[model samples]
Target: MNQEHDAGPGRSGVSRRNFLGGGLVAAAVTPLLTGQAEAKAAAAPTVDGVAQVTVRAAVNGSPVTVRVDPRATLLDTLRERLDLKGTKKGCDRGQCGACTVHVDGRRVLSCLTLAATTTGREVTTIEGLADGDRLHPMQQAFVEHDGLQCGFCTPGQIMSAVAMVDDEGGADSDDEIRERMSGNICRCSAYPRIVDAIRDAQQVMR
Candidate 1:
C-alpha cells in the first residue's frame, strides 16, 4: 500500500497526465471529423435512408428537372420542390381528387403518383392551363359560372373537367359531366355550377 501510494494513480495504468493528454487530442480532432461529416451530408442528403435522385420531365410544356427523394409523391414534388402551388393537396390518399393533373393527356391523381415515375413523361398542372395572360377555356368557364366558392377544389375540378371533355369528345349533358367528374369533390356544394361550367367549357374546348 505504501509503494502504490508513492507511485500515485499511474500505477493503475492511466495517469492524470495521460488522461489529460488524451482529452486534448480528442478535442483537437473532433472539429475536423465533424466538418467532414457535414460536408458529406451537404453534398448528397438522403431521405428515409435512401439516396435522392434527379428526375426529369416536361411540365406545363417546358422541360424540368428536380432533385428529390425517390419516394416523394408527385403532389409533393409539384407543390414543394417545383413551387407549383396551383395543384392543391387534399385527402392525400387519392380520395378527395384535389390533386388531379394531366399526364400525357390523361387525368391522374398526383397525390397517388410518384415523382420518380414521371421521368420522360409530360405533366400538366393548373399553372400550365393558361396561355400568356388568358386562362384556359375550362378555367374561364369555372369563373363565369361561379363554379367555386372557397376555390379550394377548383384546380382539380378544372383539370378533371378539361380531360373529361377531351376524352368523351364533350360531356353532352349535365348528368354526364357529373358522372365523369365524380372523382372531384367540392366541399362548398358547388356541384350544379361546376356542371354548368363544364358544359359551357365543352363548347369552347372542342
Candidate 2:
C-alpha cells in the first residue's frame, strides 16, 4: 500500500522525497566532478614518469608555448588550449576532414596529427586564413560561389582547397579538383559549388 514500495519487481523502491533529494545531490556534485576532470586534463597529463612536453610553435602567425600531453592531438591544442574553434571536430578519427588545417602550407588532418610533432612548424587554422578584415581569396570565392550550406564543414573545405591549389599549381579541372579534395567531406552535398569556388580562387591565387 506504500507508494515507495510500488516501483514493481526488479527495481529498488525509492520514496518521492528520497528521489528528489538524490537528484538534487547529483546535480550539485556533477559540476564539481566535471570541473575536476577538466582541470586535470587541462593540466596536461603525465605518462610513465614523463611530464607534459613543452611545445613552442607558431599558431595563426603568433608564437605559443604550452605544455601538452604527448598524446594530445593538434586539433585539441588548437580548439581547447588556444581557443581557435574554427577548426571543426567532425569525426575525430580523421575520416572526416573537418579538422583540416595547414601545417607548413600543406593540408594535414589536425585530429590525427600529434601536437608534439608541430613543435617547430607553422600551424594555420581557419582563423588564420584571412588578412586582417579581408577574407582569403578561397574564402571569398566560396561565398561568391555559394559553395557551403550549414557551414559546419566550410572552414576545412576552404583550407583544403587553398592548399590543393598551391600544391597542384592550379585547380586544373573540376574532376581533378574533386579527386584532390576527396578527403574533405561535406554532408551538405555542396560539391559542385565547392568545385566552382576552387576554380575561381585558383585563378586569383595564381
Candidate 2 CA-lDDT value: 0.77
Which digits, one per residue and each the tens of the lDDT, describe model 1 over residues 104-182?
9899999989887898899999999999899999999999999999999999999998899886576777888888899
lDDT, candidate 2, 1-206, per-residue tens: 11123322223576433543211111111221122343354443343334556567888888777555566688877876677899999998889899999999999999999887897899999999899999999999999999999999999998898888886576568899998899999999999999999999999999
Instruction: List lDDT for all candidates, in order.
Output: 0.76, 0.77
The superposed Cα distance between candidate 2 and the true structure at residue 84, in angstroms, equals 0.3
> In model 1, which residue pairs have backbone atoms overlapping below 3 Å?
none
